[model samples]
Target: MGNNRQTLLLSDSGYDCENKTGEQMLEEAKKNLQSMAFFGLTEYQNYTQKLFLKIFSKNFKLAEEFAQSNRTFAETFINKQNDTVQIPYLEEIKRLNKLDIELYSFAKELFFKRLKDFRIV
Candidate 1:
């Protein structure tokens, strides 16, 4: 997505990305943990497992294990960081939560489609 679009999404999630620090991002992500369950357990579990596996191939099982250990696995998965690549997993999830249900459903569909394109699920 373009930077402007991303910024708008962040705004929808109540995150002022232009001014927020890394700590603020992490804090917001933590606060969003409870709300993440709205995704439903089974769907969250499947998505987490598949996404993690797709992103971190050899570490797929690690993701599964982490899910087992963390009851808020979906939130935790969403908060995962890749410092080297600078991927903002948490922020993405936060934006997702802010979207209307129809938009969110479309986003999920795109997500699953990408996974399928990659043969990850």
Candidate 2:
């Protein structure tokens, strides 16, 4: 089987990317990016949120850095009709950890494998 990269859309009831300004879209994407479901657990979600908030509150620059995740995330969204974008939250974490590309690629593959395994389970 081939690696199919089919992506999904992020649906906002109103004021989404299609109708919103670039700044507004980025703001919304930042907020939406902070979800625990992508981490696959409530604990991970809460912890990451807290850590991000702490950093953001103390140093605004760092918060914006986390928010900058949209750049990589956009690659997936742009291909929503074709390739599947794995969870951006994990990608954000990897970026924050300053892990190299090879490590991140492995992390991505692991996420796909887990997602596949989840379907089987």
Candidate 3:
């Protein structure tokens, strides 16, 4: 008898699609970020940090009181999938104010996504 087998489609997770890494999911997100000029090395990091804070702060309003608002930041937060740990990158987002920090990481992703869309990178 001839062997007949069906192969499964694998997602980015590399296991049939479910293990989206932090960087992966973020890149595939919305595309509405802006571009700012940078000349110094640290300036790049600083820009990402500031933009990131704007993104999350919009999502988590409670943290808004803790950090300066991003003028061109998006006006929405992403719905959670399963509530995995998201505080580590978010916590240090702004300045350890906890709330702002979370927003920072998220907003930063948005910034990158936007940049990617406009081919800013």
Candidate 4:
């Protein structure tokens, strides 16, 4: 008899849903976390929000660097650009947010593999 197992393909993830090595899964988790963190940072309006997201993402260095660069860019843009000018990275942030949501769902499924019948509230 042949093995009857089916492998699910996570949308846009390029990950084989079954038989993933632990390291590969860990790498995927890292990618998801970072993407989500970037989304958070792009939307953050205050220091408290940034700090919370930094903790959630477990990437202090990235958070610090991003914060500094964002501040510098905003200052420069405001000083040089008029209100009619559009910020360049807004579209990139939107794209990342969409991708992050998908990755987050994929990670959730990977996390609850053993409890497939259970629903997260």
Best by lDDT: 1
Instruction: Return the top candidate by TM-score.
Output: 1
Clashing residue pairs in candidate 1 are none
Query: Model 2 — TM-score against the truth?
Result: 0.22
What TM-score would each prediction reach against the true structure?
A: 0.34, 0.22, 0.25, 0.22
Worst lDDT run of 10 residues, candidate 4, spans 1-10
lDDT of each: 0.48, 0.38, 0.36, 0.42
Candidate 3 structure quality by residue, lDDT tens digits, 60-119: 444333333443222234234223644554444433343223334555565566556545
* Total clashes in model 4, counting residue pairs 3 or more apart in sequence or in different chains: 0
Which scores better on TM-score, 2 or 3?
Answer: 3
How many angstroms is residue 114 displaced in model 4 relative to the true structure, after the best TM-score fit?
25
Q: Any runs in candidate 1 off by more than 4 Å, and if so which?
A: 1-42, 58-99
Per-residue lDDT for 45-90 in model 2, tens only?
4334444444354554433332213235656665564334455755
User: lDDT score, residue 39, model 4?
Assistant: 30
Model 4, position 60: C-alpha lDDT score: 38
Per-model C-alpha RMSD: 14.9, 17.7, 16.6, 13.7
Considering only N, C-alpha and C atoms within 3 Å, which residue pairs clash in candidate 4? none
lDDT for predicted candidate 2 compared with the true structure? 0.38
**Per-residue lDDT for 23-109 in model 4, tens only?**
454456555454542332332334434444444645534424334334556677667765455456555554545534545555454
